[model samples]
Target: ILLPLIFLEKHLKVEVESKSETKGNRNTSFGVKEGHYLVGNQGIYKVCKFLGEGSFGKVAKCTKLGSPGFCAIKIMKSDRAGLREMETMKRIKHLDPDKNHLVKMYECFSFQNMTCIVYEILEESLYNFFQKYEHHIHLCHIRVMAQQLLTALEAINSMGLIHCDIKMDNIMFIRQNCINVKLIDFGLALETKELTTVSRVQVTPFRAPEVILGLYPLDKSVDMWALGVVLASSYFGKYPFSYHTEYDTIRAMVQIFGVPEPEVLEKAEHTRGFFVLDYEDDDLCWRLQTPEEHEQITFSLTFSSGCWRSILKEELHQVKPSCDPREKPAPQENLEKTEAPHTDSDQAKMPIGVKKRKKVFSVKKDILLIGNLGNYKVSDVLGEGSFGKVFKCHKEETEDIYAIKILKYVSDAKKEVEVMELIRDLDPDKNNLIKFYEYFTHRNVNCVVYEMLHQRLYDYMHKPTHLCNIRSVAEQMFQALSALKSIGVVHGDIKLDNILFADKNSLRMKLIDFGLARKAKELVKGTKIQVTPFRAPEVILGLPLDESIDMWALGMVLACLAMVQIFGLPEEDLLTAGEFAGNFFTSDDGGNDPVFLDLLKRMLEVNPQKRIPPSQALAHDFITMRHLSGESAAEYFATAKTIMGSPSSSSSSNSSRTTNGNPQTPESKKLILWR
Candidate 1:
């Protein structure tokens, strides 16, 4: 019901008046007759064919009566329309013109009872293209589509506006010299600075969890979550989240992030409309819940990234709005600087000279040869990422094999090279961190030379393992977290794929991909704005962040290792793992499996404050007391076997230690495994 009568005319003062004139040239600046038609004017427009129709009006392809150029005219019922939508669009006209991936508005008119607005036409929408190709879209094509969509989103958001509708259909492709995307259908656009009721205003499936949970006063971030969904859809050909009904979808969302801890709930209640209720009947009941039950709990994905701009801000005031019938053109200087200063300092080092890179497999440049720094002959491409391709190379000076990260020009080599250099120089020492040697730009490729590693953790996690030493796994993960925090940088993006095993023993791990890493200084407090699922609840709910996030990720890694030991499944397989890893700690349901479900709860506390800090994690009874009593990885495995010696000889050796940790109720411990 965001109609014009709702608020516009009631508050606005229209000063235009009508004039006594001929039928063809009736002059009423702010009024219209019941049956007047602007098309009847010979100097105005010559309507040719109808194009389409929607809730607003009907569209027709037309030609200016006096001009040779063509445009699409949308005819609306003036008698039934309000001026809010028109005014809103008018304000954003120059921000993103229809000519360049945006539908440009020409002249708007309401002569008789009919209102007509002219616009430039485009070929087709991305929705149609995506539907035709589905998952068949090549990776390169997907990246291009993502980039175009990002550009459109960035432009719109910079204007302090929200495209409440960001589905594929709203994006169009211009079929000219090259394919480019355009954003259209401003039917649901709104200035981000204004506040609105929290009923609901987004396409489901693509909507963010915050929107679904009645969280409003939302910024441009809601759009980033949708962008992630669209990107996921490109690869899978369907919404990452889908259900039979909206209720089910909402319920699923709640299951993922439904209840905050008591303290968080208390703090969140400070907000005007936040809900305050504990999930359990009583705090004690929640406390009684076992770790296994907690591990099985799953929440919807959360996303937090400062990637786009808000246009209503002073930064983009320069982009001139389409000339208003009543207002004069704006100052020229304002139009030139059409965006706010980069708020994301991560990109601050990314100089403007570094052109937006293209999507390609290998660097389109020569090998970087440095005798004193490092002599690495770039060989075959090992893997590719958003910035560049990682290649295996042999260092001629040291005759040592290494992995050289070569940033393609299209991948924005300057930024990638800069981040690499920072990681090499500033990153603290940790066996879990990839060693950096040197960084340089060679012609078109930005090269990052680093110590070579053998296999990705993703490859090793799924391999067969008879018995895993939980203690060893915990130590390795803890060391990584410790090292990362020491450097004042959060890994930002941490998952098995980004981890590399040092050798065949699989005991050592090194982290990679600092492109998404964030400094401790820049993060918004309580917001765990990093990777989702493995994401901490604080980050999920837009809370400020801390080292606790690393602990949460480490918790997921431990769960991954434990899952491998007990269930013989990769960490991701647990995403759909039913209640077998349920949030209950009954002896029969779980062997009180310390490593399986119980230990997971202690680590994956939804409340960042409640989550076991890395220092405390090292002392968790289950990890430190039971597993690591001066034992080696092999020795511990032997002890685990001896403890499970015979079925009848069950004196409950492991069971006796179950009560040792003042085990919190199974209900209190809910774990969202990393899958």
Candidate 2:
């Protein structure tokens, strides 16, 4: 049953401020305080203190008079909304709240022209818990939460009702230190048949695509979609999508899931509001409207100083719906090819083979044979690294595509194959490591097959990426490194080119190119490892290396993505026990985030013995975003813009800063295999 305790998304600190202001006006309004009694049909509850408050009103932690235990009474501002929630709660009253993982409701009553619903007291909301813990929820904990939430959803769905708002703030634990959670806040709940296009529901980040498109007669699938988002946010420790605007959310959804089906779009009442019909390859498809297009259409009326400015019909007609079923437009001729845009010297320095690769193999005619005479059709070159050229290929009988890395030398190829074999037992997707399929010799060259992934991180981060996305990348890479370290392996080459996104939408990164990988026991002193810019200080100092070197390189990768610089090493005399402490540590201008700078300092420690490990790096405040609240994260993004967008802080400058004395051009930042 629905509970009255609806804690709004505002920070807890803000709630305290509001409480103070409300206390000053407590006598003027119908505000209830400690000592006030809420009389319900079941019993009388003594108001203890406020649990939370919103526009709906305050929920008080109350003790039942003459009873031993405590309870919660939701005092809603509007009786109409309160009655609606009570009715929804009554519909689910038959189901066992404990079994279904729903918050137990006691009774509803009116007091001082307000509606108050009594409920069994629950612990803190998941939102408050996250604020206190500030770390990624373990998969095991997530699994337990997912199961209980799903059970709650199943129970609600069985009654043919939708919770409408399934977010972290709506879910609360049964008690402290317990994984069991109950679904709360069914204030927006409605029956399936009552759904409509105009119904405003759901928090922005958790809103479904169909709902955003204004689909009528919506089903329970929207609730399921929100639950998926909630789970994703819990695991990733951030919202899965950028929720700054409906346009931004839709754009991100398109990038990840592609455009919605045409039939679905056609059924949507407000499809034209966010998408435009365009012809591509002689077929019409709906494309997301640019932010400018959306703003022009939706913000046509400008109100300034009590005056209104209406948009002209001509301006509105510019983007008139072309895909309307009633409209039959004239066919247009195929567009002509245009000349390639000229690239400046700086633009030319971007990683090569990032754009569409040239088709080097005649896939339709000759078949490329690998070990066991497996007939594969080579399509195009995926990329070229220090090890060899990787080709995109399709097996004869399967539609699945695979990346075939052809090593120039069999010796290097065999070494990489050995490393791949060592990591074969670990789940590639779970560990964020490239999935190795098979390896073989073809015409004296070694070939390794892997689950094909998208472009390299180098190609993806042409501009400064969002800090949220960077955090996702960092977390995944740390998982990959942790997996390798568990098996006593080191991914010696952890450069941008060696890490690829598992998918385009989610920023699921995987570490690639283990050609330079070595066992922890095999590490030797004075051996050069990693590419130039990502090389650890210990590597340059002729000190012994281990898996910690990968952590240092990963830190460098994160620094590059954030467009920040690692301060130069101090004089040898200043280095004590290989740790950067005292003045040396504080002198580094490692951007604004102190947590990030702290993690960076640990990873970039000059002494290999003192450097942070992969496991610890995973828990670093920078990676966990522990102290960063939603508001602070937004602030961090604002600060990140100035750092990433500055011309002086570009990749070129970063390369120069990381170099030893000699500043290298962007083109010269390729992987260096120093023997």
Candidates' C-alpha lDDT:
0.48, 0.61
Query: Which tens-of-lDDT digit does each residue in 594-645 have in candidate 1?
Result: 3322333433233434444323433444333244333233343333333222
RMSD in angstroms between candidate 2 and the native structure over all alpha carbons: 27.5
Model 1 segments more than 4 A misplaced: 1-43, 66-69, 79-82, 96-100, 131-136, 196-198, 251-675
TM-score of each: 0.35, 0.46
Q: Could you tell me the TM-score of candidate 2?
A: 0.46
The sequence of per-residue lDDT tens digits that candidate 2 reaches over residues 93-157 is 88998778899988888777878888889878877766765554544355456556767887888
**At residue 521, what lDDT does model 2 achieve?**
92
Which stretches of candidate 2 lie above 4 Å from their native place?
A: 1-29, 299-675
